[model samples]
Target chain A: MEQPVVTTKDALLHAAGALFAVHGIEGTSIRAIAKESGANIAAVNYHFGSKENLYLAVIRHVLEKTRCHRSEELLKHRRDWEGKPLLCSEAVYRIVEEYIQQFFTGIHPRWYGRIFMRIFLQPTPILWEIINELVMPNFDSLREVLQCCRPGMGKEEADLWLDSFIGELMHYVFAEDFLLIIPGHRKLSDAGYQKDILRHVAKMLIRGLELPVPVFLQEDIVHA
Target chain B: MEQPVVTTKDALLHAAGALFAVHGIEGTSIRAIAKESGANIAAVNYHFGSKENLYLAVIRHVLEKTRCHRSEELLKHRRDWEGKPLLCSEAVYRIVEEYIQQFFTGIHPRWYGRIFMRIFLQPTPILWEIINELVMPNFDSLREVLQCCRPGMGKEEADLWLDSFIGELMHYVFAEDFLLIIPGHRKLSDAGYQKDILRHVAKMLIRGLELPVPVFLQEDIVHA
Candidate 1:
């Protein structure tokens, strides 16, 4: 039988990434990562040189995997709907369904998701760098899909609607603690439940997009 | 003019609340709170008995204020629309608009908001306690309003739709970091923009409730 080999560096990266995801970078210690990985402190120092470098590398590694996986999904969606122009509602539905998959059941490790959420909650300078390289391409892809759904939708308008959709999707995933506490609410363990919720969310987004922009009230103007 | 006197306990709670909002409970230190509040370590000990107690107290204090303020607004809404039947759209719009205001521009201090978001992201045992004592009452109120909007809606169905609306609102506030990065996206500082977004979200939610549940596809069944 062939034995799979795990590099000391890979082990350290995985451990560090998990820790950093649960506990923000400032909250985690190098010693904890070393202990969790079963790597000596010297080995960690030799591999990553510095904690900051290791943190950045871990983010890069996780994001690289996410970007590649999501890009493929986007392509798959395009192929599935090829030659036929999807209706506005269909396009939005597909886009949201894809997002729901990514947010709840994507290939990224559970802890890896924590790192992404942490950055959003408590942003570091590195977030901008990640956004530019990793996030923007994916966001642009979604934006393009949305534009196809609603032709002539301005980027600014799309941005707001897109944010609303993404926000709600993220909340479903991120606010599980709060959600679980609500009377009669269940944990999203069943894949069937996830799909149903996603469809519901997609419908909401489509409806939201169709609503008229309200005329600004004087109070709103004064506040603005 | 009479000057109000603040107790040592109040000082500690105020400082601790701010720090905990910015940093998670695990990330914050007793010494930091003591220093920030200008109350010595001895005073902190004398007042709260322990760090855990102090932390709980701070959360309780913030939540107590939030509950009172939010309850008043909800009552005001009920009173304003008294004797007149509110359209489903109007009820949803009012509910969502109120949420946006409380989230982005509510009476609770900015830092207090952080503690709530943190609980959602990184849950602790205290969250269950808070949810039962503080959050449930408010959520029930929303559910009541929603039931009025869609008369005879089942509790289970209402829970799902309500989650969609709350999830979207929470996302807008929590995902500001990501939103700021999106090209053409602007800060949600304008009251006019806030109202428009609230109306948009409410419309989507109302539409979503009216949407027929999609038939499960073969692929979805397999995947589920």
Candidate 2:
């Protein structure tokens, strides 16, 4: 195996992602990224080639960290890494919890997802392909985990489940503005309860994944 | 009889709202607002008192339109405009759809919310107060609708359901910049597909509302 890469490129990406998150892709520049990373401007040019590629590299870096964190969390709880796994609901629970704690409000506190949203909504053919292929596949693990939770549902139903799974994940990641909401309803502070957003979210997912009461009485009697 | 005041402030707000939707709050100005509305700069100052106030007024104006539209949609489906109730599910659907459409290329658009999110992740107390009173109530309507759909779940479960509901709403709304995954995913060339979005969304929402197999087994007797 390649002895892996040096942390120079990694540090550049880290500095670049924070700057980009705060100022956005257009607002942040190569000069600033070079200055912040303590790397020579030529080094940036040498590695990423341009500011645009640097931005793309920065995004991939953060995504890889996120993916690895969740993957490790899921695998550690399970006995094996690759197998036909019966996913613990707790596995889903931890992914969400760790995602909230480690990523959303983590060191790179600012989120540039709105910028991503802005570009994607323009439906730029390039962005569309990334979302359809790269991002959506991130949730395939969730779909597999969710499958064990709801076996009777059809493929269409399973697809819909993935939609909600990804949808909730999307909103939580991008809609950090609403983080105050947990407290806004007095659901957090004056309500005399400790904040347990992860628990609430996990329980809600379970409810949504489970089946509803049957519409027909005759069918209900035999089924029940 | 107390007639509604036709103050310069109201005119400034009205004019600002339309302009901001097109040019964005940052893109629009007091001078243009005065020019278009046939009001002078001092007239804008007299009403909005400041540019920021004018911008906020624009936001409030669009949000008010959203609320009014929802009221009308639900009322149209109701016998008594005041007493007629929209099903919680329908209400959630309406709020989510309307809110998404409000930003996703619609009759009334305000880039303020998107811009505002960047500025105010940790919003001022006033903004939080306003959102709690306005947006949170809309969210509760969604919660109630899901509750009506799945009455057996506990409150904790419902919290997760709301999380997913908000996610779906935000996903489609913010999907403009989805290129991170879909490399070349761009906007649909055809505007007609926007309706098709609503159909897929409606289907997705229904799936989120459905329970899993354990719950399904509990209701298998039902034809649905």
Candidate 3:
């Protein structure tokens, strides 16, 4: 029987991606990448030209994977036989489920988890490119949903609505520390907690984006 | 006359905070903090106990300042005129402005910046306390404002509205990366962008958080 093998360049990018994700772009180095990938020093220079590009390559690879998986899921609910546009919250819910699953259950979820967080936090030129092409497109549908869900609303207002929606999604991503602080990390991961979060976030979006206007919302709108 | 002497401990935290903002938590270290602070090794330990604690202290100090400053601003507004029910959007805008200004400008603002980005991208334990004590209280007031405004909405709906409001905020905080990716960061900071953001955000909240009975509103809500 023959053993399976992956290309050194692929392995290099994979290893480097994890390292960069954990330590960050500047904190990672070519030598470290080479050491992890089991590749020679010169090979890094040959395959990717430099460590920066290699880091970019790693990010692009992960972004591609994440996008593909997410889109595939998004596409699944496309018609449901009736051909009505996907319910806006349901669309978001699909992404939410996949997002939590990919980062929590997948084999290399943790590897990309920190890198994805770092990339969003400390964006690089290449990181921007990935986001522009991949993530932003998905968000466009969200914006559309908000627009339809919110008629007579200006672009700015819809954007804000989406902002809150994204923030809720993000809380899940960054909630570990908060969970620990609330002394809820263990419970936060429990079935009840996960269900609560799912329902809570979903409910918030449904209520905030789909509900009516309020009276006490008047304000000076003046600078403090 | 003796000059107001900045203590070594204070200087160390200040320097470390600034460095951490620029270089990030993992990118920064104790030695770099010491070198930047001109503080002795023993002084670093005596003041902070450990590098991690220094980071936390930096976060705590910066967050306390922001909460206090913001509270003062809100209080000043309230003192001059009380029982002024601000629209959720207006409340959000004022909060956003102060939040941006304080984080972008102030002594040791760098720590706040680092923590701001860190909280979204790489949450830590200290950030949670900052969220609950320093931040959550402010939202609690906003919560009341929402209650006063949207008199008929159920608890679930109001909580949902709050979640969306948070989304609006996180987008601004994390939007630098996304905006740049969209080639919109520069535009976002522009006068037109700010106006657009303010109007849209305010509009969305006003309409989205409306009560079941309906009230004064620029527009009506459209459920998806």
Number of the predicted model whose DockQ against the real structure is largest: 1
- Superposition-based RMSD of candidate 1 using all C-alpha atoms, in angstroms: 9.9
Give the true-contact fraction for every prediction, in order.
0.72, 0.45, 0.41
Runs in model 1 with CA error above 4 Å?
A1-5, A68-86, A211-224, B1-5, B68-86, B151-156, B211-224
TM-score of chain B of each: 0.75, 0.59, 0.67
lDDT of 3 by residue, A29-66 (tens): 78888898899878888999888788778777777776
- RMSD to the true structure for each prediction, in A, is 9.9, 10.0, 8.8
- Model 2 residue runs over 4 Å out of place are A1-10, A38-47, A68-136, A140-157, A181-195, A211-224, B1-64, B68-164, B176-224
TM-score of chain A of 3: 0.74
Residue runs of model 3 more than 4 Å from their true location after superposition: A1-7, A29-46, A68-108, A185-192, A211-224, B1-16, B25-57, B68-111, B119-168, B184-224
TM-score for each predicted model, relative to the true structure: 0.79, 0.55, 0.63
Q: Interface RMSD for candidate number 2? A: 6.5
DockQ, per model, reads: 0.34, 0.27, 0.28
lDDT string for model 2 (B132-189, tens) is 6656666665555555556565555565566666666555445434423433333422
Model 1 chain A: which ten-residue window has the lowest total lDDT? A215-224
Index of the highest-TM-score prediction: 1
Tens-place lDDT per residue, model 2, A58-86, is 66554544452463446444454223322
Q: Could you say which candidate leads in lDDT?
A: 1
* Ranking, TM-score, top scorer first: 1, 3, 2
